[model samples]
Target: MRVVLQRVSKASVTVDGAVVGEIGAGLLLLVGIGQEDEEKDLAWMADKVAGLRIFEDGDGKMNLSVEDVGGAVLSVSQFTLYGDCRKGRRPNFMAAARPEQASDLYDRFNALLRAKGLTVATGTFGAMMEVSLVNDGPVTLILDSPA
Candidate 1:
């Protein structure tokens, strides 16, 4: 499992020209499921994202978690994270999980985030989505589950 976490002042996802998921002041999560990902990966990733202290405190230190600020989350499935572009001009997606498995894991991940008591929004699984966000501090991080 891999997740590209972007701290954002606001974020939204549009599908078929209609906004599907939107949030204010939170993380814009682009999630990818690998062929080998399982239940443990989901658990670990959820915990990490929930407790990550990337948000700023009143004194200007990065000391607050999203939960502390009553923020929301907009999770989107993005299989392209597994794209392998090391060789050819075209990216290869061989490492990405198949749709059935990826969809299940994606839904589970969102559920785990919701269980953390944070407001979680989500884009449709496997949909071609357009995501927009105001990146807070432009803080972005990548997370990969333990192999």
Candidate 2:
């Protein structure tokens, strides 16, 4: 699994001209699941994302996790993160998991975050969606499970 995390002041996702998920003062997660990923990947990614200290502390240091600041998460499925464009103009998505498998794991990842006592909002799985956000520090990070 791979994830792109962004600290945001506000964010929202819309599908079919309707807002489905939104948040304020939180992190936006774009997740990609590989066909070979297992529970261990999910566990590690979930733990890391929840405990990451990317937010600022009182002295303006990047020392607080999203949970520490009472923030939320806007999770979105992002299979394209696995797109491989090494040899051609058209990127190959062979590394991405099948939709059914990806959706199941995506839901599980969200559940794990919620279990950690953080507010979690999510974009519809397997949908054509529009996501908008105001990046707080424009802070962004990418994480991938161990190979």
Candidate 3:
């Protein structure tokens, strides 16, 4: 499992000109499930995301987690995160999980976050989505589940 996390003032996902998911003052997660990912990966990633102290506190220090600030989450499925581009101009997506597996894992991952008491919104799995966000502090991080 891999995640591209971005702190955002607001974020939304649109599919076929209709808004499917949206959030405010929270984290935008571009999630990817690899072929090797399993339940443990989902658990670990959810725990980390829920506890990460990337939001700023009153003193202007990044010391608060999204949960602390009562923020929501906009989770988007993105298999491109696993694209391997070492060979040529074309990127290889062999490392990405098949749609069935990826969809199941992605759903479980979001459920895990929601179980942590965070409001989790999600894009349609396997759909072409347009995500828009105002990145707060331009703070972004890449996270990977432990092997």
Candidate 4:
């Protein structure tokens, strides 16, 4: 599993012109699942995202976790993250999990985030989505689960 976490002031996801998920004062998580990912991978990545101390604190230091600032999460499935572009001119997505497995893991990952007491919103698992966000600090980070 992997995720691209973008700190955001606000974010929303639209599918077929209908808004499906939205959040305020939080991170926009673009998630991807690999063939080797399992329950432990989901658990670990969720904890990492929730406990990441990227938010600023009282002294304006980046020392507060999302939990400390009372933030939400907008999780978006992003199989494209696994695209391998090392060869030729086209990106190969062979590392991405099959849709059936990937979808289940994606749902589980979101459920883990929600269980952490943060409001978690999500985009449709396999839909083409238009995601909009006001990137706070433009802070972005990439996280990967160890196999």
lDDT of 4: 0.96
lDDT values for all models: 0.95, 0.95, 0.97, 0.96
Q: Which stretches of candidate 1 lie over 4 Å from their true place?
A: none
Q: Tell me how far the alpha carbon of residue 70 in candidate 3 is from the true structure, in angstroms, after superposition.
A: 0.3
lDDT of 2 by residue, 57-126 (tens): 9999999999999999999999999999998799999999999999999999999999999999999999
**Model 1 score (lDDT):** 0.95
TM-score of each: 0.98, 0.98, 0.99, 0.98
- TM-score for candidate 1: 0.98
Error of 3 at 99 (Å): 0.4
What's the true lDDT of residue 34 in model 3? 98
lDDT per residue for candidate 4 within 15-91, as digits (tens), equals 99999999999999999999899999999999999999999998988999999899999999999999999999999
Candidate structures ordered by lDDT, highest first: 3, 4, 2, 1
Residue 140 displacement (Å), model 2 = 0.6
Worst 10 residues of 1 by lDDT: 62-71
Shift in Å, residue 130, candidate 1? 0.6
- Model 1 Cα RMSD, Å? 0.6
